[model samples]
Target: MAKIAFILLCHKDPDAIIKQAQSLTAVGDYMAIHFDASAPRAAFDRIRAALADNPNVTFAKKRIRCGWGEWSLVQATLHAVEAAAEAFPRATHFYMLSGDCMAIKSAEYAHEFLDRRDVDYIESFDYFQSDWIKTGWKKERLVYRHWFNERTQKRRFYATFELQKRLGLTREIPADLEVMIGSQWWCLRRRTIEWILDFCRQRPDVMRFFRTTWIPDETFFQTLVRHLVPEQEIESRTLTFLMFTDYGMPVAFYNDHYDLLLSQDFLFARKISPEARELKRRLGVLYAAEGARFRISNEGRSLHRFLAEKGRIGRRFAPRFWETESSLGRERELLIVVCKKWHVAKRLVQRVRQMTDIPCIDYLFNEESCALPDLGGIQSSVEKRHRHRRALVRMLFDYYESDRLLVCLDPSNLDLIEDFCRDRAVTRLLEVECQVSDVFLVGHAMRVGLAGDRTPRETLNRLLPTIRNDMVHESDRIRDAQFDNHLRLREIDPPETNARAIAAFLGVPGDTAETLAETDHLFAD
Candidate 1:
């Protein structure tokens, strides 16, 4: 069995870090902890005392005052790597992780995966061409020299950097080195770490150049690893799962994200907050079950079955079983028309399709009554027995890229919406609430008589309460205060204005004047 060294860089949440260390210790992995120098001494002391009895664990002697997007972050990592190498000389691999990260897979499984593969697992790509590089931001990070202040922990203004650039005071990166950027987390062979250290020592200029570069932690190691390792020897994927909200904020995993964590093939997950006590307890149980040293007795088997069932591991794993390989690539946006009122949903779909050329999926329950264009048969079957709604939605998400947009109409079913959000790790959803008065008109449109042959007004009166309840439930689920990117359609606006707003929200390109005009005419009736 290959010995793996874990280099954990932690600043806050010492208890969580200790728990992670303990879980790894249970599986026989050596850990080298490097707490940020700027962090409170109490936190460092607590972690050190917690791991004192563990012979396999060591601490980095030289700690750096690590700051985000600064050279200190890279410096801290280097110190941890060196310390880990010295402490566990025979260790085959070094896994870099943060304080908030927890191993989702058992140590034995991680070892098996790494031991079978000779390639280093590092997520790297061209800095200029990657999807993360938005126009001016890429140039600001790569081209300009950013002076990061340790005290304030912020970068200098772009204007100041530009002035320095004009004065030829900016540090120049090596022309020979191809800049690569990726996720900071990586798993590498001991030999790779040694090579990187040697390479840095040999070329001090490279280190100096990167010191003033923005987010050097993301670029420094990646650039060196890509340069040193053969393309075939690189897996180009990290073993850690990190979920970011629509506004690009890192999501802290809670009970809601437990199933999502289990569904992933990644070995580890990050940003498990302290508030997620239940999730932490569950992780403890899962880690014990999946640990290599865990003996599978009758009781153990039963506990394992319970954990697996609770996690929904079997069902969630199948969605991404086959990787998407279509030439169409991932759809940028998904327009889901989910309305209880079939006619209203159908109308919205037609207006949206007319307004924007973006592809849409019409999944209304009353498919027969949805008198809309087939449009490549995106319409799903109304027969609930034929397909599981949540499963089908997951399939669509898996098929498309992560950046796609989904527009669900009349999502009165809060439970279904919650399931979709939880399964997909969707922190933000665009909710369009179409509040129409005159329930009798909608009832007439549906052409469904009430129980006991009651009049339309009486039937609507009975149904209104249920409709109101559903709306309230949905509002509670998709509370504006809860999510940063939950965009609600402005119901007070004109039909054309609302149509344009929806298009803009989905990031639909081109002029919406014609579409809006058409929508106004359609809704005019």
Candidate 2:
């Protein structure tokens, strides 16, 4: 039988690591873990104790503290790889993973999949220099020519300086040299690991590139493998699934869909806590499937037991499910038409009427709401802000509940509006800034008219780009508009109506506008 070694590199968080190990251990697979030196000593004790019973596991003899911008972490991981290689000398393949990652594949399936790949399946990508970056570099590299007369040369000089400053580099090198980045998590054939290590030993300067590169982990591996390994042997595509973490922030994996961990991706996703239980429960269906789908019993014993247990649990919860669904359907789909009092939100009611005659529930938040007849007090304010936010949350919840189309609008605050609804699974759109004003900061939050009819992936494809582009356009427009607003104020005696007038124009019902104007004395002078 071919041996497979699953290695986890970790810091602190023993509980989470152990939970992950327990799940992995249940499958009776070969596993090893390296707890980083910086992890609390208590955490190491816990980790050591947790895996002590597993014969396949081993704790490293050396540990090191890793700084964010340094190569220590990568080195530590490489060290773990060497150790695993020695221990499982005959092992066919190895998976380099993090403590935070969970296995979605059953041990058997995971092993078989790697066996089929027949090549190193570690997820890595080729780093190509963009044409723009390359085009500018040729003239900049002409240090001895002293031919700095051309505009492109000067531009290149300045651009290179700026990049050097950002990267904290003191020296300049020829730009013709190519660089690459590879994914940190990789599945490697044992031979590939031996070859890459040998190359690193032979070439010291190539290894030093890690000192200055922003993310050395990606680049070091890519550069080495590309230069040393035969091209056909290396796979450029990532065989495993992962959601990229947001830049500069760590610890949150938001709804990433990877095929391997799709079902139980987040089980060991974050540190254990009561607050995250709801998240776990939400993902439980996928969690059970992950294990059962991969368990490699010849008789399919584990799969049958898992499915039977899940079915029993499903039956008991069936009644509560329908009740919850009905309540959610009624509550989720909300119509929030954010306007000051008199402007587009109220007027756009006519447009909405054209779109669909679904007796829309309008929410008004602005300065001058009281003046409108029979004014329903929906003005956005500090006191009513929570109410408005809650309504927004409820509307999102409702949209998901109904799985039906819903729309809400916030003309001014698209960033905040996007924050509230990004995960709401709403078919969302952010209005371009050219269409709105900053004072109307609650950018409109209307459900896309066709959201309910599309699949989740389809909705995201339509909405994410529109929101991103709209935000960029709005930012540019705001910059231009700010300059125009400043110029207009300098030349004219503007009306002294304060926020109330702005509110009145915005379509807030009269009472809310009066309160806004009165509170700020916008009506004075």
Candidate 3:
């Protein structure tokens, strides 16, 4: 009989952790848990007491005070792995999981799946090839030295690091190391796990180097396994389902996500909070039914297909919102205003709203400038962060299938317009110009604390080159572009004239007099 050992890294919610652990318990299965050292002793004691009667359960003696983006997470996991190997030497496979993670499939099914596979199940991708990293700020984590203070759980930045990098300061990774990054969750054969342990013991220097890397937990094991295992022996599937938001934060699963969760064929789902008690109960029910070997229904298969297609479309096009095509059909015209300057965009939205009853939505990227909801929250797994803005615009287009659509592009965000046009052809493009000083003032205002003793005007002057660079890029990209409409903020006499011009561009009817008067007061400095 093949035996499996589970290594669980737990920090909070003792009851939930216990519940998840109990779900995976079976004869000949071993469980080794490492509770975070920072967590309350009482919580750890409670978990220990609950599992004390189980002969296969063991607690790691060496606990780490794990901090996010720190080496402690890796240390804790290693401790758990070591303990599991010691306690269950005969175990054939090791399944590494987090406290918040729950097994979606039954122990029997999971065992059957792994027992049939001779290869290790882990997700490993080249860091440079990953779309998410290429499209987001995660690349900085690889190139920069990020130091995390475990005591405070805060990132401490070195002011001179950027300068050092500019001056060709470099850190050399080992010649044999091929850096790989991916999901932290994995399942490995006992031999592979032991090999990893022995490799780490021999290469303490490699481990030490990883300690300085940002979020080493995500890359350390991934890089090691990819290097040690033969390419053909590795299965690139981590049987864990995780959803991330636009900001790279994990999306909290709720009861509403039950259908979607069920559609996934993964063995486990993660980051489930205690607040979603209903979802947990529902999952338990599904697990019981599936544990009995219940076949997926036709409806379930259809739903799965639908979800998979949606995911594919989302990755290629846009994030899915709950709104239907019929709901947005009432609007005859749709206007998308994209700008970095929130105040100006807000004013424009207000004027447009006053001018016409047709539904108008303003999407602003700068979080600090306005409270209006933006595309920043639409982080569907289908699209990378760099492609998120385009996905959002496409979603808007799908939702509001209006007769006419007007999109305004900010000079700084002209790249978005260019990408969007490339992906989906647009007949009309409108370019809006604002005073360089005004744009600089807004940028400076947002970075007040970082400016030290510099005045907003002085700071603007210093950042002029960067602003000019953006303008140059925008001009180059749009040089051959044909615009059906164009407006310069400073050139328009009376704010109403610009309002009327925008109304004409959007092909909507409105009382320009009232809109102009209202916007005049709004633009008054």
Find the candidate with the highest lDDT and give its number: 1
Candidate 3's displacement at residue 30, Å, is 2.3
lDDT of each: 0.65, 0.46, 0.64
- Compose the digit string of candidate 1's lDDT tens values, residues 114-170: 889898899889987787554356756766677765346434555667687788674
How many clashes does the backbone of model 2 have?
Answer: 48
Off by over 4 Å in 1: 150-159, 166-171, 290-525
Alpha-carbon shift of residue 307 in model 2 (angstroms): 30
Per-residue lDDT tens digits of candidate 2, residues 1-525? 445676678886687677666665554445567787877888899888878887767655677876553467677777777777776666676776676565444455565566665676544454553332222333223221221223335675456656755776554432433555556767677787788778768767655545544446665666666665677887775444443222323433334323213333221232223345444333333323443452211211221232233323211212223223323233233333332222433344444444443333334333323222221343334345334444434444443444433233444443333333433333223121123333222222122221222223433354345554555554444344332111111102233333234233333455544443333222122
Ranking by TM-score: 1, 3, 2
Weakest 10 consecutive residues of candidate 2 by summed lDDT: 483-492
Q: Between prediction 2 and prediction 3, which has the larger TM-score?
A: 3
What's the CA error at residue 13 for candidate 1, in Å? Answer: 2.9
TM-score of 2: 0.45
Each model's backbone clash number = 5, 48, 2
lDDT per residue for candidate 3 within 476-507, as digits (tens), equals 55644544343334333565665565555565
Between candidates 1 and 3, name the one with more favorable TM-score.
1
